[model samples]
Target: MTKQTEELKQQPGLILQPGPSGWWDSERVSSPCVLRCADGKWRMWYYGGDPHFDREINLPTGRCGLAISDDGVHWERVKGPLTMGAVFEPHSDPNRFDAAHVGVSDVTYNNGLYWLWYFGGDSSFTQVGNMRAKGLRMQPGCAVSADGWHWLRLEGPYRGALLPVGESGEFDELFCGFPKVVRDRDGSWKLYYHTLHPEKGFLVGLAVSEDGLHWEKAGQVLGPGSAERFDERGVGTRHVLPIGNQYVMFYEGVNNSGYHCIGIATSTDGEQWEKQDGDATGGSVFAHASSGSGRWDARAVGTPCVVPQSDGSWYMYYIGANEGGSDELTSQHQIGLAVSKGTDYGQWKRWGE
Candidate 1:
């Protein structure tokens, strides 16, 4: 399932578009936090939705937003809600426990400060009335800031709870969230998240911390019946990059292809992982947006958030869909970019058009 080459041929690419009221009118920016601003400018902590919930709770209560760019490729959303208060009661709201949602986020910069590992949740109290309470029971939430714009929330529960469902009946006891933290050159600290195992639906879990907040759980780093195959229907690990020393995970593979595609795997010691590009019968490594023929990326590209560019080239930042219909309620998810020139994960390209 890899065929399309009308010959635009640039190769080393750049295609970030969604700031003109087209990424679903500007309200669904999932799991992205790429920062590099000492004065050079390039900050983005995304997860947005407000218009009540983008016009009366269409779902997705994610609530972290702030954008700025000098040259990371045109961005400018900075008005409010950068992890600001109230998200579940008495959770002590440092920034809040995902007031009802706040799924993926990874952003790093250690020691000096500027770490954010997110995954908060509350599905409107577990869909009390149904419809508006779809999934997600995530945990893992933390925030820190030197000047990433006044953030504080940092304390226990960096990842706890959510192993119920018969003590791990296979995931989905209602807890666990998409928190991805990585730092290991010698600094030590590795975390990759995503949970749910009432019967193992969404998996991708691992944890380790030296001083990030005391965590330990290097179990099940990609599930739904490992390698033998069966993605079952869930997989998550949104971002993890190291490149040279080898460590590149950019995941989100929900089976049957109703949508969600973007896979990649590789780890040297980040903790054993292999599947260099999409496997598990679902074809690994995916991203589409040529559309010269109309089904480039009909709707759904998964959540990937990569960044590495001094001039070496590598910018992935994913999430796509200009329309809708891959199910999961559908609202036309959005956010796109795909460029790979030398990290050698195999020359990816999808940017602009």
Candidate 2:
């Protein structure tokens, strides 16, 4: 057997299950954020809602919810939702840009304050009636908080839409959400986000910021069919962890089989990426189904958010689905977790590996 196989066989079985007291069992949770709070606890933020069985509603009104963990394994969601409605920026034309249902995706700490990057829009409703609704842009915005609880909207659309297909078309015409931001070793800020292209499907894009207020697209960091043989259909939201000098991106991939699976890619300079073979590819590192026999996430897994701890163990947060089908619009999804053995991003062996 290979080294990765040997590692997997030696580890204990760590399954991704709902939190205590059905904390996340009732609601569909997606886009998880894991952070070690200054208060010495693990905090998780995720979008929660009941899947809409009705076709009348264009999209689910996803609200942001908070959960806390002591050991980073057993979690308890804090009481009540954290943020809601159209979050306004500190110095924007409120009349022209503040109208939309807003939601937070990823949160990070900087200069002793918590900064949140999120997506806001009313496009789901507008898109249903007029195709021109494509003009609506789901862009990245920011908010800040002295304490982790209370927040204030700080900036809006630091970067414009993703790359516009044509001069006339909006860059992020379809949608762009699930943003993950991190400060590079050089002190520049990098944001990785999911962008939807009308014809190319959904993929991840990269943007850079100097002062954290303004941003510019670097280029397509991860795109569809770039590898041709590997990620043919598309790749979506990723949680990146900087290990040593390189960065490891754990992201979702949809193949020609129409099945969703998680995979890992490494970047030496944080721009160019090489897909890892064996466990890093599909079967070993990426699991198609959940651990449980009849669980909700038995069908597919995606939206991987990872946190590296001081203890040398890594925690990965991702979304799981019970529905056997591979449609993004489906509702049987929940947020889950997997643990890796070491701090090395390249040494990721799946839970129980």
Candidate 3:
């Protein structure tokens, strides 16, 4: 039987802070993708943005970044080998789909190849948002890498999004991005993402792909919370893990109060999901430490990246913030880590804490 994960905990010891005051990543680093290679080395791909530019533009100033770690806990940024500007590709032409900004949220490796799914900012000339939301008609871009380090992006429709936003009145009418893609046992690709609903702040949606490049939307998999629930405002940035014929998805949830926490849901088919909530906490599976501790993530948590460690254990890489508790931050954001004993996926502890 698949163990029902009751909770995921956070520790204070594992944290990767922002870059120095003058560096490109001085403000925040989020949306981490961790891959454990056969050689036992850990490589991470994350996005960084200037807090000032993020608020000034009212959008994600996300620039793709890289990090390497011998052990999952210790880390160092890739300065020279990564081409300091952008690892994948950046928006240059205003006519392109990702003219404003670009950020990579999901990545996969199989048979010595790497597949990346990135989210692009609003278009330069067109209107892509829905009646409720008005921002970049966010979409997913595809890229392949011979090695996890170097990449070659697609062009034309191949470079375009795997699944564009839904038509009028669809669940993903406003915007859809933050892809969490994985291959099922049947060799089909299952892509999960978060989108803005007309009434719901943000929701989770599913798409399927036959070749990891071509995709088709399935529908909304998860929705917002009740008026008084923790995820009442939104549920964004999901990470899906397949375990024993059941799939577990970890999501970033926002309440009406704008408090961001981690939530979990379970699915049997990867298409339908049931929110796993706390009877007392209103379904929040994971929460930040008390603000009194002055922890880096006291304010909120989002952008979950879950990787399976050797020896049957697991590691989760996520971003944390202590101010303005939503996805958009007025303050700094940092990277944090959590660990799970190989015995159970439902239980987690702060890495090295």
Clashes of each: 11, 3, 4
Model 3 scores worst on lDDT over the 10 consecutive residues at 1-10
Clashes of 1: 11
Candidate that scores best on lDDT:
3
lDDT of 2 by residue, 59-142 (tens): 322455667788775566666433232122222333322234344668899899988776654323444234444214455667
**Candidate 3 lDDT tens digits, 1-353:** 21211111244734576665554566777778888877777888877765444443445446777778998777787752432444754556666666666788987887778877788865433343432322357787777887766777765362365677778888886667888887988889988888876456788888888877778888887888777777888789989989777998888888876677777888898888888765324567567767667766777777888787557877778887775444455655778887765655556666656
TM-score of each: 0.29, 0.76, 0.86
Query: How many times do residue backbones clash in model 3?
Result: 4
For all predictions, the C-alpha RMSD in Å is 20.6, 7.1, 6.2
Off by over 4 Å in 2: 1-26, 51-61, 81-100, 123-137, 157-172, 225-230, 280-284, 290-293, 324-330, 343-353
Taken over the whole model, the C-alpha lDDT of each candidate is: 0.57, 0.59, 0.71
| Model 1 stretches with alpha carbons more than 4 Å out | 1-33, 43-72, 75-107, 112-179, 182-190, 193-202, 212-232, 239-253, 261-296, 304-353
Question: What is the lDDT, from 0 to 100, of the residue 55 in candidate 1?
Answer: 37
Off by over 4 Å in 3: 1-13, 51-55, 80-85, 123-135, 156-159, 278-281, 324-329
